[model samples]
Target: MKVAVVKYNAGNIFSVVHALKRMGVEPLLTDSEVELRSADRVIFPGQGEASNAMNYLRERGLDRVIPSLTQPVLGICIGQQLMCRHSEEGDTDCLGIFDAEVKRFQPVKHEDKIPHMGWNSIQNCQIQNSKSSLFKGLDGEFVYFVHSFYVPVCKETAAVTNYIHPFSAAMQKDNFFATQFHPEKSGEVGQQILRNFLEL
Candidate 1:
């Protein structure tokens, strides 16, 4: 399959690339509208400040291109945050691919952390359908997550996880799919998620 990973100023791009290679898919990394549009599937993965990432996407016209993709598109980490309507980080407006908002974590207790790093189990929330689910065969599975910000339990939520509180670990809306966690770094569980995404 012609898998394309969106190229932008974000971390974890190489990790995502390597993960795909492990699955035997040589993914094309590009920011070109034509290349992205022609791909059978596309993945947008990143780790960065929301404002800076939004600025990068806007400059490359990817802000417009990404939202308009007709094929299955997956967003990871900050990529998921960017796909939401707005982000509390830098008080920025985002791509609006999902009708959601990204908010900074407000630590309430002693154990509550700023960046909720490490593995956390996920509960499959209301998935849109079986055909495009990334959580298929996943039951209380632990995936890698490293983020300070989180999207709340929204209509588009496909999976839920708790750290400071319950948050949307994975989300989907039509052809768009996203994960707040880094599935690429989640080991076997991560690989399974990628395999499920590839099948779609």
Candidate 2:
């Protein structure tokens, strides 16, 4: 199957590339509209500021091409945030695939961290649709996260994780699936989640 990893001016692309390679799939990393649209599956993963990433997507005209994809598309981290309606990170409007909003983490306590980095287990994970879940029936499984912003529990939310509070760990809307955590860096469970997405 042809899997295209949508390339943009964002970080953490290579890690996703390497992860797919380990699964025996050499993903096509490109910003080309033709390459992205024609692919069997697309993985839009990134790590960066929201506005900058959206601007880059806009400049390349991928901002529109992405939401139009018929095949299954997975968004990770900033990619997931960009799929939401809007983000507080840069006071930016996003792709609007999911009816969600990204908000910055506000620490209420001294121990509450801004970035909310490191491993955390996901809870309330269940099947949102007929497709296999991004959580892979691993509700209590820990995944790696590194972000200051999060999507609150909403209709599209498939899983929730508690850091400073409950937030979306995984979300699904039709063929569009997303994760706020870095599945590529989450070890065994993370790999299973990727496998689940590939299977879908």
Candidate 3:
């Protein structure tokens, strides 16, 4: 199957590619509309600022092309934030595929770090018997996360993680799936999540 890792002005692109390679799938990293649209599955993974990333996407016309995609699309970290309706990072408007808003984490205590970094356990929030494909067979698993902004618990939330508060660890809406954590760096559990996305 053809998997495209979106190439843009964002960090961690190679890491995602490496993860897929470990899964025995060589993915194409491209900004070309044709290459992206033609792929069987698209992975929009990034580690960067919100507005800068959005600017790059808009400049390349990906902002318009991404939301219209019919195939499965997975957004990671900043990729997930940009997929939301809006973001508090740069007061930016993003691709409204998930109908959610990304907000900066407001630390209320000393331990509540601004950038909630490192590994954290993710709880399956899907209703009884209706589990998310992303979390299939993996429950209460720890995933690596490195971000200061988060999407609050919402209807689209597929998984939740607690740090400063309960926030969206992963989200799913139709063919679009997203995770605020870095699945590429989440070890075995991360590998499973990426494998699940590929199999979808």
Indicate which candidate wins on TM-score.
Answer: 3
Write candidate 2's Cα lDDT for 1-200 as tens digits. Answer: 99999999899999999999999998999999999989988999989999999999999898899999999999999999999999998899999999999999999999998799999998878645443366655778889999999999998988889988899998888899999999999998999999988987
Compute the lDDT of residue 30 as modeled in candidate 2.
Answer: 94
Give candidate 3's TM-score.
0.97
TM-score for all models, in order of appearance: 0.97, 0.96, 0.97
- Arrange candidates by TM-score, highest first: which order? 3, 1, 2
Q: Supply the global lDDT for candidate 2.
A: 0.91
Candidate 1: residue pairs that collide: none
lDDT of each: 0.92, 0.91, 0.92
Question: Lowest lDDT 10-mer window, candidate 3?
Answer: 124-133
Of 1 and 3, the candidate ahead on TM-score is 3
- lDDT (10s digit) by residue, model 1, range 100-184: 9899999899888779999999986457545336877786888889999999998889888988889999899999999999989
